[model samples]
Target: MDHEKVNILLVDDQPAKLLAYEVILKDLGENLVIASSGREALEVLLKTEIAVILVDVCMPELDGFELAAMIREHPRFQKTAMIFISAIQVSDIDRLRGYEMGAVDYVPVPVVPEVLRAKIKVFSELYRKTRELERLNQELEDRVRARTAELENSTAKLRESEQRRSMAIAAGKMGSWDWDWITGDWMWDEGQYRIFGVSPESFEVNPANVQALLHPDDVDQLRKAIAEFNSGTRAYETEFRIVRPDGEVRWCVGTAAATIDANGRVVRVSGVTVDITERKRAEERQNLLAREVDHRAKNALALAQSIVRLTRADEVKAYVNAVEGRINALARVHTILSLSSWQGAELSKLIDEELAPYSLGGQIRLAGPEVQLLPATAQTLALALHELFTNSAKYGALSTRSGRLMIAWQAENDRLTLTWEESGGPLVRTPKSRGFGTRSLLASVESQLGGQAQFDWRAEGLLCRLEVPLTRKTAASPAPGKFDAAAAAELQRASG
Candidate 1:
């Protein structure tokens, strides 16, 4: 018999991409449908059956994630495979969200022909298998109904119907069981044997055999549920863990109903058992993510509070500007962190952003290896850089057209040393007294970051050197946020 082709849907605002996808998948011998927008995609999906969907992540009106979520809500499309393609970097959180929204896979913008074709082929085959299984189940139900109505069927026909029923049930991870309490008799189907990791030819239908495969910790819960059912509970549902013969533990849930005799005594019980190991694992991961979000929120609030509390200004305008600048710096760093799923950010990118206004022309020079700063370290550095940038614009190298600033850094032996050298500006001189700016700068480096900062006053300009302790692993763990007044005062006094 000639096989019917499964339809593959391609969605993107760009026609070029849709055309490319069509060419790549045309050889698979599947029917391809192209849609330029999400609304159009939905219309096509409603009209025709789709085995797989390839959608662009960044689109007008509806993005790939929103499209996937909507499609998943439709019962007919819940099992359809969806692949998300994006040009932007996918963070850990974004990848997790994609999976949660029913995305089967993710592909980068520059599509690999071989990889894309292989993934689509696999899902398409799976779709065909699922359709076949559904057809088999429908046939089995039909045969059973026919046998029930016409009880005069031949023995061979009856045997074929029984085989169909068993095959249909064996294809799924669920099974039915029956227990006769009155006669100490039990019965299980082929599906039940597969669920318990055993074969019908080697398995026995008895309480001892069933209990032996149950996890030790969950045995009591199961027995308690049985006791409750015995004590007049008509129906009850409970969960337990099954320890398979291969030493793998899997979670299972069952709903059973008691069959009462004429005198109100239990005679038999029947129910369906389902494997739910993946669901349990998803729940655990969600709990962990919740805790991590809470931790990050607290860290951000602490950093913001410190910035607002320690900032000082002589006038209302100055105070507002100072507070705003510091918070804006924090916000910039937060954006970079979000792109990396709150991981560390590169040192060069952070400096370029903080000094964007003064970065016009060749005034700002930077020399450093690619260094990823811990998220906390980046926050601390952002606020401190804001102070330095502000000072430079008002009184340092950036204030003059002919002036220049050179920023350099070196990382060696698990430490990062940086310098800010300003030249060709007004002559520099040592101040007679320590001001709020000096104290604030010292505290940012010495207290929150646990780093060292040294100032040099020259006739031409000023140069500052910083030594920070950093490593890759330190990104997740942060230093204390509280500012130390005594330490800041001592550093300021010594510097003066």
Candidate 2:
């Protein structure tokens, strides 16, 4: 629990200033790093766990502002606090820019040693408090885990005790009978007569009587299970159908254990039998329900696949190759959804996989932050990328060997911006008419992703931009429909 060894980073172009600050804060008991240049400061920050950075604004080759910007851009260094020290007077705009670049405070130079030391102490105390809180939280978690383990152990013991009590009560209420092979005799308990629905005085203990009471189909299995138990090869647990003298059939569960004489010869086999007709019926019902559920799920998936296949069928032979290809795309989306437990898809990876074929040969470039997409967003984006790839392959950048395309996206403050740029295709001119592919992309982006789509047909190439809000992504999604005929016509007319 040593709180005195907190790490601090000091960046200044002047050696004298560095030494002066270090001397003033010597009593604070911190490990202070002094760098004479911004580059040197960055090197120090990279190698160490820096609690705070005190930087000089004016320096050669990456000044404080530039260095701060670099730090903010890096995900690992995003949370590091920066304090700027400058001798020159800074305007309101300059101060605002510093704050925008993630500077937490500004210290004027020709510095006061006492005031600087006190500021350093305040930051050091805050860092210590954060570390202390983290330690306490970890301790609390460990205690909770121990308590949970004890509760689980107690619950297991209680379940085991309950099971033993249930088994004893079941044995007492039911009945048991035994057969002595060596003595060639049979015996039955009082409860056994009750189970068979017979009076003890009317029944005689004999093999013939027992055989007559058992259902014919279960006689062989019942004998086999008993024989296996006597040979010490298996525990005796068997289910069979039994018939009463009055001709009523009932399901029964029988369990037996073997008794061996002194010579290691089987003396007798004894066990309990219980009526299990209700239990058997319940099991059958459960099995039927399970099969029905499995069948329905398969049919639903097949129906969805059929809908996708039919909708894309018209464009298959003329624009693409076959209906199977479109179906496969839909299947791939389904696979992604399944792998994520139907949660959604990762937007960047989805785009990369869908565009990989055309992206080869430097025809396309992709860049984006990692963001998860809802099911609707995933399907819409997949279809849009498909149309873009198809159009490019037929007449745009992907048609020529020398063409290039850049597909990039960025997420900023909960908004996502995606851009598609093309180059080195046929001489750029306005399209004569809007096509099905163009219309699909626009409608899908707007309605499915809750986004805006803009098309720019510049002389250099065709550029498409989309902007979307990230909040619309959800776990459960509604079905996405196809683009209307009017939108398709509009795209065709604009292009023509």
Task: Give the lDDT of residue 203 in candidate 1.
Answer: 81
Q: Worst 10-residue stretch by lDDT in candidate 2?
A: 475-484
The lDDT per prediction is 0.83, 0.74
List per-candidate RMSD values in Å.
35.4, 38.0
6-121 per-residue lDDT for model 1 (tens digits) = 99999999998889999999889999999999999999999999999999999999999999999999999998999999889999899999999999899997899999999999
Using Cα atoms with residue i matched to residue i, what is each candidate's TM-score against the true structure? Answer: 0.55, 0.36
Per-residue lDDT value at 32 in model 2: 92
Residue 429's lDDT in candidate 1: 79
lDDT of 2 by residue, 1-496 (tens): 5655788899988898888878988888899989898889878878897878889899989899999998888786787778899999999999999999999888897788888877887777777777788789888888888889988988998898867755664665567788786786888876677667677899987877887888999899867876676666435787888788888887888887778878777778788888777778899988965764454355335434433433433454653453344445566676776688656799877776678677667677777779887655666667677777777887888889888888898888877788989999876777886665676567557754678989898887789898877766531233222222222343344334
Give the Cα error of residue 3 in candidate 1, in Å.
Answer: 53
The parts of candidate 2 lying over 4 Å away from their true place are: 1-316, 319-325, 473-476, 479-496
Q: Candidate 1: RMSD over Cα atoms?
A: 35.4
